[model samples]
Target: MQLKIVLAVLGIVGGSAIALAQTMQSNHGDGMDHVTHGQDKPADAFGLTEPGQGAFAALSEVVRFLEADPETAWSRVDLTGLRAHLVDMDRLITDTVVSETELPDGISALATGDIETRATLRRMVPAHAAQLMRDGRWAVEVSVLENGMELRVTSDDPAVVARIKGLGFFGLMASQDHHRKHHLMMARGNDVHAH
Candidate 1:
């Protein structure tokens, strides 16, 4: 059982790494030169957009830095460094003008999942997890409950959940609705027994 959990955690980490790699590769050639969108355009498309661009630029800089020399880059990145990166990225996104362009349903779903996963892991894991946001990419500590495995997600956005689920451990962290329903059912069962 333990070995299975370990394998599952490895699978998730490996899958997320691959996804991040693919995303990075796909976005590599563009590098903030242009913005590509599908059929729908965001409502606030032209409102105020410099910050997002700047944030992406900053992210690009970090990616380059890491690519140039990972060993040195990693050493320079401490907890504070990670937090600073996140702040910078958050500032870039929040300050920028957002549009009604539906913001991509997948992006929102992934963000929601990311937030939930972070919260769940934080609550369940004893070790501290670090987060870094740079060059439009983010590195967040993701924990697998099966074997207490720790992995870092490197991505431009919060769309790392798909990769997380691919690892197979995501199902272990029950969704909020699932937990609530289970609790409700248990409570009902207890009520019947008490009567």
Candidate 2:
């Protein structure tokens, strides 16, 4: 009788442990670890997505270039280059229009800077075809052809968000100057762009 009771207790404990392990594994999504899950996949992933590879790639390249040499990046923006980039972005955004909820206070701060800086941002953010301003830190809704891409930028100050929204890659470069250190750029897929 004593032996049977000990075996039963051991069996129950082992079964509980296995069940807990399975639950944890499922939560992690096959051990891949999902950072976010949304309704619509990102535009870049969508096949018919208009903001095709060229548009996104150009933006990425511009961002990288600016990040590498922020001081002189603006100087490189000529009328022709700007127009070409804008055209590509326009193509992408026409289909991927994203709506934003509320603009964050920090993003509003960009308006406080000098006339030139403020003016630059005003012209640039819209020119880059950003759809709307949202409540998250460094947050903005971007439209593409097939779907929209929600870009969430997190930073402590409005200056940083303004710089990035206005300058794109160059703004990210400027962020390095700030005291709050982490610079995270997240591009989500699915309904992640919606809300």
Candidate 3:
């Protein structure tokens, strides 16, 4: 028992030391000396806080929120669904190709990818288009194509049109501030895309 306890303590201390070293190295590049910036406490007290990787960080945040809330329904939670959605996001970002064209009112884009990527685009693009249309900012339409998907966005205002063209396909897909809330809702077993 004593040997196990000693090993556990050493493991934690070693992990903390690694985190502190990584934090100091990262902050060094930004011209911030983490060591001298503190007068009251040692720099080792501050360490890397992020849980690493974009998707993992997002899921960590959701789990933290759920743990803090008393009303979280543990039985209804669907973290697997959220993980699948994050995988889809990754595929969308890395595997797709987009071709854009200037339109009189806005812009048109054709997005194509391999077999798996095309399936991801088909699932995500129309759902995102629905979310964008709810704001009434632009007329968004998504058409399923054999090769991939087609997205056309239009607005009567020239400024909004220019903004649409500037944003192109990826920007428009990522435009909404709704993703975090959607993730939380989906984790709680709510059908976020149903509406």
- Please, what is the TM-score per model? 0.17, 0.22, 0.75
Q: Model 1 over residues 18-46: C-alpha lDDT tens digits? A: 98987777765554435564225563454
Question: 48-148, model 2: which lDDT tens digit per residue?
Answer: 42334654554554455456664643544433443343453343334222233324532222221234333333433443323323323455433221221
Off by over 4 Å in 1: 1-52, 70-195
Better of 1 and 3 by lDDT: 3
What lDDT would candidate 3 get against the real structure?
A: 0.89
- What RMSD value applies to candidate 1? 27.0
Q: lDDT of each model, Cα atoms only?
A: 0.37, 0.40, 0.89
If both were scored by TM-score, which would come out higher, candidate 1 or candidate 3? Answer: 3
Ranking by TM-score: 3, 2, 1
* Per-residue lDDT over 88-154 for candidate 3, one digit per residue giving the tens place of the 0 to 100 score: 9989999999999899999889999999999999889999998889867789988999899999999
lDDT of 3 at 77: 95
Q: Could you say which candidate leads in lDDT?
A: 3
Off by over 4 Å in 3: 1-49
